[model samples]
Target: MAGSLPPLLLVGCGQMGGAMLAGWLADGLAPSVILDRHRDDIPAPHSVVRQASDLPDDFAPALIILATKPQKAAEILPSIAHFARHAPILSVMAGKTVGGLTAALAEAGTPGATVIRAMPNTPSAVGQGMTVCFAPPTATEADRALCTRLLSAVGDVAWVADEAQMDAVTAVSGSGPAYVFLLAELMEQAGIAQGLPADLARRIARRTVSGAGALMEQSGIDAAELRRRVTSPGGTTQQALEVLMAPQAWPATMEQAIAAATRRARELAS
Candidate 1:
């Protein structure tokens, strides 16, 4: 609620963090303190104090949301670890691992910060994002519930018990939005091939993808059902589907791509 006590300290107010912040404000939960080196881009919320050397003199937060770049997190952790040590941390960085953060924080004498690795995609900016979270084994029921409620403001949230699967989460949902945009790109090119004007092709292609996505959101049915609805038997949509779903087509290639990203996730963590 707007006037209610805050539970979080957000570090790095970039795109992903901004998405989460927008979600929280929309849901009526605002962070008590938000810290970022540059505060220009964030929308001003009256209650959130964007920059202060330390957290407020009030009760310490139970959670800290980290949305900084992976490369910058290691550099920033030591300075900010004090506020985090007493709180569970949720990180949205793509490749950084909690272990590295833990070690870095420990060096600052700020130990015992529980880390929850989260991967959220760009769609979160519009409240239709998919967020996958992997919390430590010691994470309690209350902790999970708190995070689930906080993150749900952005979009749907799922939990993975094994942290090892988080890399795959990053590979899939984390990097998945760009793939959809890539589809739009190819669709535009296809329209150009069909002899439409370049600008018109671009508009049509963008609208087609956007409309399909909106339809999926409004319809309660699973994607398969929706596909079937559009794909009449022996029709144009069906023909396109046949090629798109082929063994060596987009599906298989996507699987391989996601796997590669997962491997890269592991490498980054190491």
Candidate 2:
């Protein structure tokens, strides 16, 4: 609750959108209205208009949060085209530039709509997310600040001056969850290959990743410090680190993966 947050409007209520809604509700933000083609997932006691075509004439939302898939933005825009001309638009669609959103909003009639585009990671579902955003050049400073505060309701939000950096942001945070999940999967498989019981392998992998993450979060120290603390000269941990960080190793592989994702993001934007 940033004191004077706009009357909320949620466009897509999928996982990311649902997580945001949960955060808002937990923070006691009862949106003026919510819209989603599907409505089975939201909690009880919500007031949703449900359809764009049937929008109530008297209703006016101060901020419209577009949380739909990047590919679906065009399809979703016309549904709320009327709001494009009035409300400041806050978007969380990856690879979508601010100018593109403004154009969409202009087509909907909100020629001067203040637009903010953001790339948010999956951790927002638990308030541990990393989010980056960029505002249109025409956006007023006050509007940008309001957008930041609005996004902060869910998790950590940082502003980006360059919209071109958004694809890199998408590669880093937007695709980061999947990368971590893949690491967990590979860790479990490795444990199983080491002859541990399947159940034990799964359990150990889950706990190790979770505990390491928790320690990193709880401690104010940097991750490098924590990693060094676990390493000892000529010890087992050192041996593992050597293999993982060597010239031809996981770090390089991860960089390649990130680059590939970055390229794909650029392609999507194009």
lDDT of 1: 0.79
Best candidate (score: TM-score):
2
* Model 1 bad stretches (over 4 Å): 1-7, 41-59
lDDT of candidates 1 onward, in order: 0.79, 0.79
10 residues in a row with least lDDT, candidate 2: 1-10
On lDDT, the leading prediction is 2
The TM-score values for the models, in the order shown, are 0.87, 0.91
Query: How many clashing pairs per prediction, in order?
Result: 0, 1
Provide the global lDDT of candidate 2 against the true structure: 0.79
Residues 43-88, model 2: lDDT tens digits: 5445665677766666677778898888998888877878766677
Off by over 4 Å in 2: 1-6
Candidate 1 residue-wise lDDT at 141: 80
**What pairs collide in candidate 1?**
none
